[model samples]
Target: MEKKKISIDKSACIGCGCCAGTYPEDIAIGADGLAESVTGVAEEDVASVCPVGAISVEE
Candidate 1:
């Protein structure tokens, strides 16, 4: 399997919870109130759901 890197630009995150709501297994809201890739579950869909374009994936 190909390894992927998930990056979250907290600055751009609107804290909308869309990522966490859509993929609770992959992402979550952190103490700073930003979306974080907690589990590194490798779900690219999370990036698509981000309203502020905060998530990026590199494969």
Candidate 2:
């Protein structure tokens, strides 16, 4: 089985938190106000909802 992972590009993130709102279980805004992956498989959803294209997935 593959382990799913998600990451955010801090530089590209606009801190919209849309990814967080879309997938609260897996994404959230860090102290710096950047989108962060908390847990579970959120890569695909984050990448799709992020308007700035700041999210990426590692399988």
Candidate 3:
């Protein structure tokens, strides 16, 4: 199976740090105060972490 990549919608993000707090290994807070994919990959089910649905997993 192919690995899924995590995508962060900057416009939709509120910089709540929920995703980063939950998945510190794969997600982080960027300089812009928005959620960013650390390795452009998803090691866990993190799409549901965002309260605004800013995080998404892509195949």
Candidate 4:
């Protein structure tokens, strides 16, 4: 298995917090009101849940 990385585009984030809600362990809402990837493997569910297309996974 390979490690996965999640990255959020702050400019594209809409502060909806949906990504955080979808993956609490891997994402969080920062003080800037944007969803941030904290830790854990990046899943498709998280990217799919982002309303603003801000989340992406790195293989």
Candidate number of the best lDDT: 3
Give the per-residue lDDT digits (tens) of candidate 4, residues 1-59: 34367778899999998878877877889998887778856675567787778777765
Model 1 has an lDDT value of: 0.79
Candidate 2 residues lying further than 4 Å off, grouped into runs, are 1-3
The parts of candidate 3 lying over 4 Å away from their true place are 1-3
The local distance difference test score of each candidate is 0.79, 0.78, 0.83, 0.77
lDDT of 2 by residue, 1-59 (tens): 23357778889999998989978878889999897777846745457788988888775
Residues 4-34 of candidate 3 have per-residue lDDT tens digits of: 7878899999999998998787788999999
Question: Each prediction's TM-score against the native?
Answer: 0.81, 0.78, 0.84, 0.80
Instruction: Kindly report which residue stretches of model 1 are placed more than 4 angstroms away from their true locations once superposed.
Output: 1-3
Task: Provide the lowest-lDDT 10-residue window in model 4.
Answer: 39-48
| TM-score of model 2 (CA atoms) | 0.78
How big is the positional error of residue 2 in model 2, measured in Å on the Cα after superposition? 11
Write down the worst ten-residue block by lDDT for model 1: 38-47
